[model samples]
Structures are given as structure tokens and as C-alpha cells.
Target: EVKGDGRAEDAYLLATPYNRRVAERLAGAELRLDEPPPPAAATALPNIFALYEENIGAITPLIADELKDAEERYPPQWIEAAFREAVSLNKRSWRYIHSILRRWEAEGPDYEEAGRDPEADWLERRYARGKRGAGRLR
Candidate 1:
């Protein structure tokens, strides 16, 4: 059972062990909680969204945090495109997000600097499509 007085700090402390660092990162960045994309948005591409959430869930409790934090720094369209691409390539891991954010923190939250394309080799393996007799991606 979760016992808390409904304080933000208390909630942060209660985050899953794997997610504590993520929480700290978001908090340190001065993020305020905010809502995430609708469930339907994610349902269309679970692998993609799962990949996106994996990174977000690592550092922040909710999507709102990043949105709120970046509101002043990044344009909504840029964030949207970045999010969509990140989900598509499945590069939304903790490490990847950290790298992306570190650049943002240093240079500024510019989408051009944050761009990362999925590696062709990784894509071939990730889907393993049309590869007969392939037990798993190489």
C-alpha cells in the first residue's frame, strides 16, 4: 500500500527504484507535472509509444513534467515531431533521453540538436521482417 500525504517530494520518493534517477533529473530541471498524450495516440504504435514512455517513465512521473518544463524553451510543433520520431525509432531509452537532454541543457532545447535517426542496421534487426529462418534479430 502506498502511504503518502500527497506531497510532491513524497511522491518522488515513492517512485519505482528504476525510475528514481529519472525523477531526480526531471525535478532538477525544474519541471512541473502535466498530462501526457492520449491513450489512443499510444495505442496505434505500442512499440513506439512504449519506447517513448520507457524513457519518460525513467525520469518523470508524468508526461506533463517535460511538457511543462519545455513549454518556454521549445515550440509545440518541434516537441511533437521529436516525440513522434523518438517513438518511431524506439530510441527513447533512459540513456538516449539523457544524452538528448544533456545536449539541450548545454546548448539549448533546439530540435535540430536533439535529432537522432534510427540506425538502418538496428531497424532491420528490430523488425526482422522478410528474414526467413531468423530466430532473432542479429
Candidate 2:
């Protein structure tokens, strides 16, 4: 039996744990189980959009949509690291950053920069003309 008499006790009861269920029961409502809250890690992640805006350039609506898609497809840490890598490489294009994310997804990330330029390799593969042409497009 609840001790509330529709006065301060009622207010106190509403303020306490289990009070919501007690009030609902008093009102002749069915008991419903509470859903668990989201994980702490989810809340603790840094806002990738904010990080991008700060480190990269301003986001257009198209870029915003792409960012949303990337956020869903990639981990927050990967996105942050991609941004940092783009800045370090002085390649400030979203296409460049997005390519990094895609390569990381496909080939797994290389944590050690170690004098390796994956971007250069990717670009060479993408635009390499012919053996005779070398750097020139066929």
C-alpha cells in the first residue's frame, strides 16, 4: 500500500524510484517493463560531424548526407582517424577522405604510416595509364 495522500507524500513518491509504477498501478493501468537505456559508449563517442566541421571544411547538404551515410557505415574512431589522416596528408577533399574510409573498410587500416602512402598507391592504381605512358593517361 502506498503512503501518499495526494499531498507532499504524493509529490515525494513521484520523485522516487518505483513511484511511477506505483502511481500507474493506483490508476488501474497495466504494468509495463522498462526498456534498457543506450550503452555508455554510444553516448561517450565524440560527434564526428563536429569533428569534421572543425578539422575539415564546412559541410554542404550533399556532404552532410554523405557524412550521415559514412557515420552509419564506419566506426566513429575510423572517421576521426580518416579526418586526421586527410589533414596530415594535406588532401582536404571529402573524396580523398572518403577514399581512405573505403580502403580501410576493404583492406583493413594500416596503423603505421611508416613511409607508406596508401593514397598515392590508390591514385596510381586508379589513374595509371600504361607502361609506356607511365604517369600520363592513355
Name the candidate that leads on TM-score.
Answer: 2
Give the Cα lDDT of each candidate. 0.51, 0.73
Question: Could you tell me how far off, in angstroms, the CA of residue 19 lies in candidate 2 after the best superposition?
Answer: 34
Tell me how candidate 2 scores on lDDT.
Answer: 0.73
RMSD of each: 18.9, 11.1
lDDT of 1 by residue, 1-138 (tens): 122234343443566876877665655444334546556643333332344455455435554454456545644444555555455666655445445555666777555544445455456665685456456645
Q: Residues 13-130, candidate 2, lDDT per residue (tens digit)? A: 6456587776666664332224366567645656777867887769899999998999999988888888878877677888888998999999998745577775676567756765
Report the number of clashing residue pairs per model: 2, 0
Displacement of residue 26 (Cα, Å) in model 1 is 56
